[model samples]
Target: MAGDSLFGIHGAALEVRAQRMGVLASNIANASTPGFKARDIDFKQALASLEGGQGGGIAAATKYRIPVQTSMDGNTVELSEEQTAFAENAIQYQSTLSFLNGRIGQITRALKGE
Candidate 1:
């Protein structure tokens, strides 16, 4: 209970989001690298599994992204798609952080009885 109370799903979410950002950033960085396959995290699936008591941490949620069009250089990372996913993940990360901060503030106020 102590562990859950201090962080809960938001903590896990932050970790996952950070990891996803890294994956997306790597894809963007290697967009021109031959045979580079894009990877992504299934956010909704990961959250659902965690919430349902299936504990695998963040690593279990990652998946390879399927490209709509394969390049002649054998690179699979789509720059535009990766950029979109990165931006979206960044927004979600910020939202989770804001939520965690609010939760912490609430707890602080409750402890002070004011």
Candidate 2:
């Protein structure tokens, strides 16, 4: 019962989101580095595969990001693109956390007969 209640799709989603945040943060950090290519995870595909009995923990397949405008230094890390992706991922992470919190609250209330 403990395991049943603690682990679910939302839990998996949170883990994936955290991983994505790390990748995006890395891209942002390497924005000015020469020849650094921006990389990102395929969130939807990874999550779907994970939920479809992939027989593994939450993980995403990292892929290089294509730049709209090529730089002379061969750096593909676009500051604006990285920033946007970071913001979107952060929002998703927070949303998943809030959902998990609400689920916990519901369970607690039920246990207390409230």
Candidate 3:
């Protein structure tokens, strides 16, 4: 159960990060759209909900995005902010992958008795 839970948690975090990246991309893509506001996911709350027996936290985030900036023309996306957030999210995602990979390597080594 613990291993299943860890895998589930890691998968959920990965999905959330991916979706957040998509949102960030959407914001960047619609930068010229007069009324777009940038949006983001609440990772902490999403993860909590998933871990609280909610059947994977990533599902909690796939549907919608919370606006970070509201525009006069009803647009919630801001180019500069979206770009910054995207960069940061990408960095975090890479770090998460690196850590997962390291863990995998350790597991492999232990299995091989190396």
Candidate 4:
């Protein structure tokens, strides 16, 4: 959190978004695997934990997703839902990255006395 002051919440946000992307990707990858239960990160909770200086980070915020429709094989992944979440997370990740990039640019310009 010490470094967070440099970029505000965007730094932690980027990390959470990246982790969420992986979780969503995993869900998408295991969509056909029987008994595979989809899991996702609670972005707010994860970010809060990080900013609050608490341990556990993403793992503590990770939660099993409840399926919109149960499958006979017990696989909880819904491909469409996972895909949509992934896309949205990807967009958010990009936005966070952009914010960080802009911040870095400002720092660079300031350092150069520009």
Give the TM-scores of the predictions, in the order they appear: 0.85, 0.85, 0.74, 0.97
Which residue segments of model 1 deviate by more than 4 Å? Answer: 6-8, 53-55
Q: Model 2: runs farther than 4 Å from truth?
A: 1-7, 55-60
Give Cα-based local distance difference scores for all models.
Answer: 0.86, 0.82, 0.70, 0.94
lDDT of 1 at 77: 91
Candidate 1, residues 66-93: lDDT per residue as tens digits?
A: 9999899889998999999899999999
Best-performing candidate as measured by TM-score:
4
Error in Å for residue 64 of model 2: 0.7
Candidate 3 C-alpha lDDT tens digits along 1-114:
255443556755665678788877887888778866556677777766655657645555544445665667877665676788899999988887777778779888989999
For residues 40-67, write the lDDT of model 2, one tens digit per residue: 8888766776667565434446688889
Q: On a 0 to 1 TM-score scale, where does candidate 3 land against the true structure? A: 0.74
Tell me the lDDT of candidate 2. 0.82
Question: Sorted by lDDT, highest first, which candidate order results?
Answer: 4, 1, 2, 3
